[model samples]
Target: MAWTWTYETADGRETGRSAEFETRSDAESWVGEAFGELLEQGVDQVRLFDGSDEVYGPMSLHPA
Candidate 1:
């Protein structure tokens, strides 16, 4: 299954999506590297998916 990410706003509006990845680890790594840029683009949070199944997240870009 392809792994992917959906970028969202603080209010839960989806604003963007990521390129499909071959593995969940790759998807997570990509998000780890890109979250800063995503925040600059107005994405406050992100969700990970394994095809149609949600793996995790609504993870915030801000440090907590």
Candidate 2:
């Protein structure tokens, strides 16, 4: 399975998603660790998406 990072702009109309990662855990961890920096830099929001099931964050970051 692979993982993807998605971010929606503050406007809520614009959205961008990243490429897939080798593992979901890696993806989630990367997002978790990068979120603060992104937010600090002015990112609106960050979310993790699973390529396999199309599930979003809150689940991706959950401990497995």
lDDT tens digits by residue: candidate 2, 3-60: 7877666654325666688887777677767776666655676566666465654222
Least accurate 10 contiguous residues by lDDT in model 1: 8-17
Query: Once superposed on the true structure, which residue ranges of model 1 sit more than 4 Å away at CA?
Result: none
- Screening candidate 2 with a backbone cut-off below 3 angstroms (N, C-alpha, C), the clashing residue pairs are none
Which pairs in model 1 have colliding backbones? none
Scored by lDDT, the top model is 1
What are the lDDT figures for the candidates, one per model?
0.91, 0.62
Angstrom error of the Cα, residue 21, model 2: value is 1.1
